[model samples]
Target: MTATASPTHDAGARAALIAELKRSAPHEAAMRIGLEPPARAAEVLAEMNPAMVQDILEAIDAEARSRIAMAAPRELAAQWSRNAAYAEGTLGRLMDPPFATFRPGSTVGEAIENLKSLVRTAFVTYGYVTDPEGRLLGLVTMRDLLFNDHGTKLSEVMLKDPFALTPDLPVSDAMRLTLNRHFPVYPVKDEAGVLVGLVRGSTMFEEEAFEIAAQPGAMVGIEKEERIATPLFGSFKFRHPWLLINLITAFAAGGVVALFQGTVDKFVILATFLPVLAGQSGNTGCQALAVTVRGITLGDIPPGGASRLMAKEFLLGLLNGAVTGVLTGVAMFVLASSQDSPSAVMLGVVVCLAMMGSCAISGISGAIVPLTLKRLGADPATASSIVVTTATDVASMGLLLGLAAVLIR
Candidate 1:
């Protein structure tokens, strides 16, 4: 009789072959292998690259995908389906259902027994106590369960009214809540206040950190979904729009300079300082934009309080402008004097006034652009740098050259 391969050996060999196919072939082929055992497909997909898993799932045939979804565990299906249901940056996508929970009436001994079994397969940090309707009541830490009497009721020992996150809350807002109150796991609730899942604080932190790191690129018009593995054409499509916008803005700045061509020719020295003024003002605007975006993301700037925030940024702009303006004026005075310009002192005064005005406007523009976008229901970081830079460039050039035309003449 021919020797038979054990079920374990056969499964292991199948898994190995599927993994190799996943690495070497299109995701559809690997997904077909996963489809063979629909019940295990969720686990296999979870282990694969999450960045591409959603696309892979979409590529599968509708009937096969539906069968796999039906066969998978409810929580696993929910997690996989979250991409379609929730907005990309919400807390729902970061939550998982693989958590330890118990009824409020369960005894400490029973909870411990349940945990013992779950601990072997899942990460068990806290025991959630919920009411009959699955509304969360409290939490019991592992340490509490260990130290309490085995006969104690979980309801009597649990910490009531613990911090929880709603499913629709943005992940950035969720992260701000954890800055002062750190918990390993936070319960997630639906609109009805029933506990739906749990979000790991570490996971939220990682996702938020990645988002924050990507903000600079996002400001420059890079898509958040574009990864190193993105195809060449994909990257080109993602990047072209921003470049076109930047080009248009550049032309606007050039138009401002063309309007001041007469002044630039009369006082060639003024031409030398245009870039200096624009660069300084652009940097100042970017600083304010960074702070405002961070504040908006963290929920620090509440609704109806944007005016106050804008006022603060505006005041900061004026103060920073005055300080930097005086120094810049002195440098312009010295440079013009060395060049023996007849209107050296007047040129210094013109530069000082221009710097102050440009810096002030840049600061206000930075804060206002993001806040306005948020109010209009657009992404605060979507090509904001392009807009703000264009504004500062136009303002700086218009002020500097216009002033030179008036004051130097």
Candidate 2:
């Protein structure tokens, strides 16, 4: 608990520890590793999630926590503590404390002198100008600091009413706002516009990138925690449940086909088109799903935008279905004529109509599945592919068989 920052520590070990801490769930896993007697607990903790660090520190022995915190420079420990109070996915969770600041009346010489000491343990990117109550007024760039005369007051040189991110802003929303600005660091403010902390562009982007990367796996029921580096047993533990759920959904699709066994038996050729229809419908749904997920991830979906998104996807599916249907219908007609069937023309027409209808439903399912999951407070992409696949399969096979049963029977 009282260990100082020793010069010698294992780099590999520290990195492994940090990776495990990041991969850990509920911060409890982090707490166990946090209690490990690393040579520099504070520094190791600093490299990890602030929210996790805060939870781990709070869970451990108070004496140990305080001593470990004391080992780090005051600014970092304090910042991590404050950042923990925010939710895991918000900007506040990623902020570092604003260590270098000066009052409006402070001269450039005074700011430079203070930064001389501040840069030793921390990276000083920009100097902040704030009122006595910590309301952010402006930002003083390093170039402005050096070029201007030492006698110039901070108020005169600083950029007034600087752009800032609110702590509660979701990382996706933050990314949308800052995509073009590309500033090295952004100051974070509370609802009252009081400067609270700073978020590095690198850190913010990296966090969002991890979420975006996890989306592919999440779509098919893969747990977000599984990574290429994950242990075999751990990967199995993460994936087994989702695979089971996917199987269950698959059975639902199968059941729909089974219910119309008589229809399929009477018209053996119907079996041929079932898979084709199902595959086409499933692909259409997947396309819609991908776009909708991307929109949500990038914060492109506006308020009450769900209906518009679904409608757009539906129209695209309708157009695509009609085009692909003509080719499929021609194939159906050729097969039926070779068999000398009486209803060749009608069979082809049924296939075309079924394609259009199934695709329309599939496209809408794609948008609805993820949107519904998000509304239910689950990850938007989690098991979404499974749900959409089931919906499309049932619609495709059921529609093709049902239409033939009614019109041809």
For candidate 2, the per-residue lDDT at 243 reads: 88
Candidate 2, lDDT over the whole model: 0.85
**Largest lDDT belongs to which candidate?**
2
Among residues 3 or more apart in sequence or in different chains, the pairs in candidate 2 whose N, CA or C atoms overlap within 3 Å are: none
Error of 1 at 77 (Å): 1.5
**25-85 in candidate 2: lDDT tens per residue?**
5334545565676436877887775645665666677777777878877788788777868
TM-score, every prediction: 0.80, 0.88
Compose the digit string of candidate 1's lDDT tens values, residues 1-409.
8999998997797678546544432343545655467766655665543323445666677777777788766766776676446666788766677468889889999999988888876667888888888898899998888899999999899999888999788888788777888888888888887887778888788778767877888888998766665567868988998899899999999999999899888888888788888998999899999999988887888778888877887788778878888988899999999998889998888888888889889999999999999989888988999999999999999998999888776
Off by over 4 Å in 2: 1-32, 48-70
> What number of backbone clashes does candidate 1 have, counting pairs of residues 3 or more apart or in separate chains?
0
The models' CA-based lDDT, in order, is 0.81, 0.85
Evaluate model 1: give its lDDT.
0.81
Q: Number of clashes in every candidate structure?
A: 0, 0
